[model samples]
Target: MNYRSSELLEKAKYYCNELSKHHILSKYWYELALVLKGSTARGNSDQYSDIDLVFFCDKNILDRIVKDYYDEGLISREDGIFLPLPEWIGHYNLESYDDLIGYFKEKNYPQIWEYTNIIILHDELNRFSGIVEEYNNYVFQDMITDIKEKYLSLQLTLDWLRHPLKRGDELSVILHCSKIIRLICQLSYLIDEKTYPHDKWLFYYLKQTEFGNRNENKIKELGKNIINNSIPLQVDKELDEYSQYVLAESIITDLKNQIQLKYGNEPWLDEWYSFV
Candidate 1:
């Protein structure tokens, strides 16, 4: 659980900066870049939003330094709750800029966005200032990959729904609907060209999208009809299932069109079929 803090963010930066100056704790670490990330850097700190310090040093040594600060009564190891003036520090580290870029290649675009959204607590030489375009290219490619994977998954789920729909198995159909809804949310993030602000904040972000803004009511109505069978008995059950079936098919058709329109020129990653 993240606790909301009005003033804790600034305080965490000041103290950590001072700590990095100390030789006993910082050692050779001060030569590397120190970044403040996560909620605090993003300006959305709650009580549990521990100061996420990404130290660009040896990963093993980063843990030891965080432990050293914990021993000094400057920062707490646990969530900064119940303690007075707690700078709950959570630490992550990368060895160098190359190591950081390696992380970009491995993560989802949304997560890669999080890594790039950082506050430089200590970087005397400004080593990280030039990574903006490099990261942006990585994010764009990652999103394309994510969209392709989602398109494939959506196709599979639509195919899976056929059995449940034919059997009039309401429970199985609703369960499949839930899975599709999750995919829709994920796909919407890519289509809308918005970084996923994480699941807890999904609804907050979703409403801001043009697609979600317009279709919110229909999505909710369809959700209720599928999940709870809330429509009156006068509403035919078979008709309801058929409606869901059409919606799934429509989603697939629409998403394929969106993909082609947005990324038609992107070279295929690999050719699965050829006249050999």
Candidate 2:
């Protein structure tokens, strides 16, 4: 963690502790989970980074707590983001996840994805931890129980690879390789049941997953070769785009087989009709 992140974390911890001690919340304190999220939780904080906190608890309790936070000026203003808090500032969002589950009876991927990237400062009731592990075994279709759409995407993108390589179309070859690699990367996160944060961090954190860790070197090599295709169309006599086809082919092939071996391939076939 960088200096600003470390310092922000400390201040956040203190603020939460204070909130717990206040007369308004002391009794219900244990029920609350003070979740540190966003850029700070990702440990890439700068002075300008706004600290976001998620409050997970019962609706009544959360309502009370949010009102208190606002009254103390401990919560932020809607006017604009607080500039680098050289001093203590309140958490910007009174984000509540469980309260959503209570109202809606389910959680969505966007919510799940946010919860996945968190620094849980406090979860005395032990609710947030269980929610985090809601993802397991295989990725859900939009976090639904039955969806194998990710693999279908992987297979389709994989199929496109052969044509470009056969035709020796340099641009098409590069485009297909890029898409295949991205699909594989997406599937890696789905298999591991983690959120693909979808930015520079997409690949950075992919290597942290069970699938990505095991195939780290291969993924890195493939990524490097594909990305080395220079922009503005530099022709390299030395480089052959077909070289990547074998590597990508191997990756998708292995992933496809393993997923079928473990989960069986019926979900996509059964549910795909609805999609079409």
Candidate 3:
């Protein structure tokens, strides 16, 4: 690992240790911390940026433990149910390795690995590894195959929106643009080991990825125009259609190349978007 990764690992280790002190999670359940999205690849993980954590436990025992902690005042509740552990804590969830991976696969949950540093507790390491292996063999392999198809379908969507007839309607453009952003965001996590940020940081982190570049500027311009227009035009005739086309094409091409490189072409590639 480079210096930044090494530092990140250490910080993650420190966090695990602190959680252990609180009896929230210990080194035994600590699996590994993963880097998701952002400039972490650029070595820019700082205090303002939160590090996401996935705390795995035996499904049967996990809920009991969390409940016990809350009852004892060792933890506090947010939103009446969600436990707010500490300031630095980003995402916290409990799942047995088996069910958790299944949920991940089913939901197309991105960033479960990215910027995630898991600390598997000692006794459960074997269980954790076994589940991961099973997922790799079954769920993950299928997921890789799905990634390519989704990318191809995504490209088709962008291609359709690029047609002259479809290009002029601002509402239509916004709809297609939103779909493209979502596809790229989801696909980025699927391939590059990325994750969508928590709701609080979603837009900011989106702007930090390739998907952001494709849609953020236009979304911002449209947003401002909408706010300023007393009666918003059904379509913004003033918007730069040519620039939008170029941006959309670049994003589609980048996504296609990334999909091919990460997941070889699969015959079922286009079918994957049915889930979308």
Determine the backbone clash count of candidate 2.
0
| Each prediction's TM-score versus the true structure | 0.65, 0.57, 0.53
Error (Å) of candidate 1 at residue 210 is: 4.0
List, in order, the clash count of every candidate structure.
5, 0, 28
lDDT of 1 by residue, 117-218 (tens): 677777765655555446656565556777767766776776787777777677788888777766766677787666665665555556776556755665
- How many clashes would you count in candidate 3? 28
Across 90-140, the per-residue lDDT of candidate 3 in tens digits comes to 434444555557645664444344323233333234655555555543435
Q: TM-score: which is higher, 1 or 2?
A: 1
Worst 10 residues of 2 by lDDT: 77-86
Computed on alpha carbons, the lDDT of every model, listed in order, comes to 0.61, 0.63, 0.52
1 or 3, which is superior by TM-score? Answer: 1
Alpha-carbon RMSD to native, per candidate: 6.5, 6.7, 7.3
Per-residue lDDT tens digits for candidate 2, residues 1-276, read 888888878887877777677685587768777788877787888777767766677666667766665677765753222223235354534445554453223424345566667898889877777655653322344432322666666566656656655655667867877777776776777666555665546677777666777777887777666634454333443233445766776776677665666567755533443453
TM-score of 3: 0.53
Q: lDDT of candidate 2?
A: 0.63
Task: Evaluate residue 231 in candidate 1 and report its C-alpha lDDT on the 0 to 100 scale.
Answer: 47
